[model samples]
Target: MSEHTRIDCDIHNEVPDLEALYPYLPDHWLAYCRESAFNGPDAADYPESVPTTARDGSSPKPDLAEVQARVLDDVEIGILNCAYRVQSVRNEDLAASLATAVNQWQVEHWLEKETRLRASIVVPSHSPPLAAREIDRWGDHPGFVQVILPVRAEAPYGNRRYDPIYEAAIRHDLALGINYGGAPGHPPTPTGWPSYFIEDYAGMAQIFQSQVISLVCEGAFERFPSLRVALIEGGFTWLPSLMWRIDKEWKGLRHNTPYVRRRPSEYMRTHLRFTIQPLDAPPNPLHLAQILEQCGAEDLLLYASDYPHSHDSQDFLLDLLTADQREKIDSANARTFYRL
Candidate 1:
């Protein structure tokens, strides 16, 4: 790859409306939507009122040409992570149908049209069996590079019930992308629901931490050695402390989890990659450098614009990294992780 080439690991290509998916959905599901008068699942984690939902002067639903004019013109490749909120629906059957429809929509509307684009397979993650089947259904498509599940779920993703998802993903050589957003009907935080959207947004890193710990201690990495995970849109500033705490605690509790043979941090560094959008950098540039050094995350970070969502300037963090490290984070890491 050229040194100038860049790969964006996370980008959104939202479904404009239920009508857009009508062609992809089966007749049964089409009838269900019509008879129920269901418009679509309310999937946006960041409300439309929130400024972070879309950048200034950009269309909410950007067409391929707009995306090319804006984002693709700058990068060599971009992976589409459709935050369609298929996981939010309570009806498992309908959820599965929507997941299939979303994947087909990506195939026809996005992937087939752009060689520079790749997509993640959207799944009905609430139903592991259905999610696994969806992975199997589209796993072989060259345009899809990963399987995306929501960060919030009924149970932690590492639970035995999700083994089918892990198995199918590994079978397809697809990375498991746990992207931020999902309405599991549970409070976003460990406590009850927050009164403000700020509280909900700030608590996302905590949720991501819990999922990381769950995946490690539950031995998901041990059982499925080939499995790879990308934590998208969840900030990375908290990782150093999380890694230290988990590793320290694992030593005392190692007897409880005999399957987790190595230190938790080791498994995390080995199997996980994090997208660097919503970076959560501190006001001081040196602090960000220290955090990166503490976590030893040079190879683990991937480039992402999290297009359509606004975030604090990343120039400070980028300036802190060396040229080689910057290259890896810019595109090399993603290329290696996604097998592009």
Candidate 2:
């Protein structure tokens, strides 16, 4: 690749521990936490901490400066959108406080120190009102560019309950970001929970598909025309298949979802954005190009390292594409999509 601008659209920042959040909590919650002997919730079961870190050039222990030197400076990222791993809480108020603490920690520790860092506002999974309040608090902060939710949400994200959340995003000119992480309300798989990590990994694409369908069929995009949903760590191959399937079904089943006036793909094209971390490298490299063309995703795609988490063979996934595509994926597309 030639000299080009790079912007990392997805990167993980682990909140060291719960004790770090105590200072940000209300007195009652603080007392409750101390009284309950709440050190922290057990670490969520995400599989990224396996051998893939060394395999993919991620630090086993990624602190702010370590990430800055190894991932950001190494790749020459002009901006890195930091997403936290702090969304596993069950209580609404406590969840909001934890999210706030993580953001505050980032603001004081990372954003204030690093010039190239920007982040998503992590919100409580089950509470839209509280989530919206978090957005309202930090939406104006230059360091926070979007509101981040997990695609593995308590419900399909576009349900009416989440309208207030999206409304807050629109009201604040912040994009809504959805990453991977399932909640308990839904089965990990369509049939049942996965027993192994591979099974869980296999279902991630389906999770993304279900989310896009929910957003389109439920008219989330229509209701908030300016609203944009960034699918961080959401891979690309399944998108074409979903677009075709939904548009085909919508033609015959429009009455069931009259709010979706246009073809499903049309709305997705206008409203959704996806990160390219674990890029869909097919057996035949040329076939990858076909997938991009089939899905009409040249502009919709954003480049992400998924730093210290997903291990891409190469830092960027546009090596197979033409030079122009490489340039756009590197920085231009992210600039427009995130309104940076």
Candidate 3:
């Protein structure tokens, strides 16, 4: 691939509304949604009014033309992650149906229309059996490169209940993308619900950290050696500290989890990749470079614009990286990971 070729690993393709999915949904679910007056799943994470949810002047539900102008023009390839909040639905059957609809909707509306685009297979992650079934349905589709699960779940993704989802993903050779959203009917933080959105938003790094710990210590990587996970939208600045802490604990406590055969940080570095959106950069660009070196994250980071969701400029971060490191983050890493 050309050094200049950029593969945006994260971008949103909004599902306009319930009506838009009506064509793809089954008759039973279509009637149920219409009669029950369901306005579709609620926004589980980002509030609609916030400027961060939709950048100034960017469309909340961008059409193909808007995406080409705003996103595709800037990159060689863009992977679409539809944050439809299907996991927020309490009814298991309905949630599964909605997930299927979302995947099909992406196929007809976006992936087919734009060859430059690829999408994540949305799943009803609350129910792993159904989620695995959804993954199996479209896992072979060339247009889809990963299985998207919300970062927030009823249990850590490494729990036994989620094994079927992982197995199916590995069988299909698809990466697992844990995007930042989902309402699992629990508080966003370990301390319980916060009064303000800022508190919840800031606490997301903790959630990602817990999931990483769970995946590593629980031996998900050991069980499925082929599994690859992408931590999307969650910031990457907290990684170095988490790696140090986990490695330290694993050294003395490895007896408790015999399945974890190697150091936690080793498994993390091998199996996980993080998108560099919402980058929590320090005041000095040199500090950010040092953090990347501490974590040995040159091959672990992937480029993402997180289109339609605003974030601070990343030119400083880009400027600090070596030409080779920047090329890997820009496109090479994603190309190899997504098998594009």
Q: Per-residue alpha-carbon lDDT of model 3 for 138-214, expressed as tens digits? A: 99999999999888889998898899999999989999999987888988888888998777778888899999999
Q: Each prediction's TM-score against the native?
A: 0.98, 0.92, 0.98
For candidate 2, the lDDT comes to: 0.75
- The digit string of per-residue lDDT tens for model 2 on 80-184 reads 344444455676688788788778887887788887888788777578888888888888998888888767776887798998888888888888778766454
- Segments in model 3 whose C-alpha atoms lie over 4 Å from true places: 1-3
Model 1: per-residue lDDT, tens digit, 108-167? 999999999999999998899999999999999999999998898899988999999999
Which candidate number maximizes lDDT? 3
Error of 1 at 310 (Å): 0.3
lDDT of each: 0.89, 0.75, 0.90
Alpha-carbon RMSD, candidate 3: 1.4
Model 1 gets an lDDT of 0.89
Backbone atom clashes (below 3 Å) for every candidate = 0, 0, 0
What is the Cα-based lDDT of residue 314 in candidate 1?
66
